[model samples]
Target: MRIYPIETGNFKLDGGAMFGVVPKVIWQRTNPADVNNLIDIAARCLLLEDGNRLILIDSGLGNKQSDKFFGYYYRWGDHTLDGSLAKLGFHRDDITDVFMTHLHFDHCGGSIQWNKDRTGYEPAFKNAAFWTNENHWQWATHPNAREKASFLKENLLPMQESGQLRFIQRGDTSFLEKSELGFDILFVDGHSEKQMIPHIRYKGKTLVFMADLIPTVGHIPLPYVMGYDTRPLLTLAEKELFLNTAVQNEFYLLFEHDAHNELCTLQHTAKGVRLKNTHNFDEIFS
Candidate 1:
């Protein structure tokens, strides 16, 4: 199996929102903000190439939104989903599965795109099955007031319309359930309902995809939960448990939003579990 880092694009978000109640004085040290108090965010997706299946985890924000709609996020950089795929000598049609961690726009927007005629939406990955659990599919489709803005219909409805959407059944257990993708899934509700974090066993190491849960290295601390999380208190407990397991198992965390850091290892510190070392995908795998 081969794993490739697909950088879709970069955008800026309010640092305060990204780091919740964590004081700017603390988070700013790691993810420094610009004059407008916006920090860099990456829509970094992962491509898993196994025998006959080419699975993509998270599609990133596609370029279908209107300028006014995108103005809010302040997107930057020239990286694009198609361009990134081409770099790897692949294309959208090559993807056999799109494993979405959650249905947030930044994560799944690329799942749908405007058709050639500009009449309606279509599945961006024409040949792939879009993956999201039953719980999250309902949560995103019938979104609550707080998360409604993040779960854009344009990014979702088309997949169902195209008849390519598939739901993963969440086991009765709380976390770490076996998935058809040849990895175990760790479900955490604090960020979004049933956000599936894939625990991939690759090359003798377990690599956990850190979706919105622990988005960046700045979010390693237990208290650094995102303000966007529905239940912050629950996040604290979940992070503690996950971090402990990650440390014990020596898992490599793959960050989705972290612009600078791609993968990191955790070490038990006096304060708490902290980043031990950081490396790019090639550096670690090669």
Candidate 2:
């Protein structure tokens, strides 16, 4: 099995919102903010190749949003999902499965695109079966006001219309049962209802896709939750529980929003817990 890091794009977000109640003095060091107090973040996605299946995890924010809408985030980056796929000798059509961690625009927007002539939306990966949990789907479709903006309809309706949308049943980890690169799906609702993070066991090491649950290494501290989360207190509990398990199992965390750091290991520290070490993806895998 082979794994590839697919960088879709980069965008800036309010650093304070990203770090929640964490003081600027603390988070600014790891993720320094711009003069506008925004930080650049990567919409990093993962591609897994196992035998005949080429699966993609989370599509980045697509380029379909209006300029006015995108201007807020200040999207910047030469790397695009299409370009990255082409670099790997693959294309959208090559993807057999698209495992979305959640339906947030930054994470799932690239899953659909404007069709030719710009009449309506269409599946970005027409050949792939879009995977998301049934509960998460309902929650996103009928989103609460807090998360409504992040769950755009243009990015989601296309999949259901394409007839490629499939909801994984709760506790069903057999999504990749036939593949050598099978993953253990870990669901947590603190960030959003039933968000699935894939834990892949490869080469005697476990690599976990740290979605919004742990957006960056700086979020290792228990209380450093994101302001965007619907339930901040629930996030604290979920993060603490997950971090404990991650440290105990020595799992490698793959960050989705961290622009500089791709992966890191956690260890117990006098101040609760902190990053034990940090490394690039290729460096560790190589």
Return the TM-score for each candidate structure: 0.96, 0.98
> What's the C-alpha lDDT at position 215 in model 1?
96
| Alpha carbon lDDT of each predicted model | 0.91, 0.92
TM-score attained by model 1: 0.96
Residue-by-residue lDDT tens digits, candidate 2, 118-219: 999999888899999999999999999999999999988889989999999988868988777658998899899999999998888899999899999888
For candidate 2, what's the RMSD? 0.9
**Per-residue lDDT of 1-286 in model 1, one digit per residue for the tens?**
6889999999999999999898999999999999999999999999998777899999999989999989999988899999999998999999999999999999999989999999999998899999899999999999999999999988888899889998888763422234333488889999999999988888888889999999999899889999999999989999999999999999999999999999999999999899999999889876
- Backbone collision count in every prediction? 0, 0
Candidate 2: stretches off by over 4 Å: none
Clashing pairs for model 2 are none
User: Which of the numbered candidates is closest to the native, going by highest TM-score?
Assistant: 2
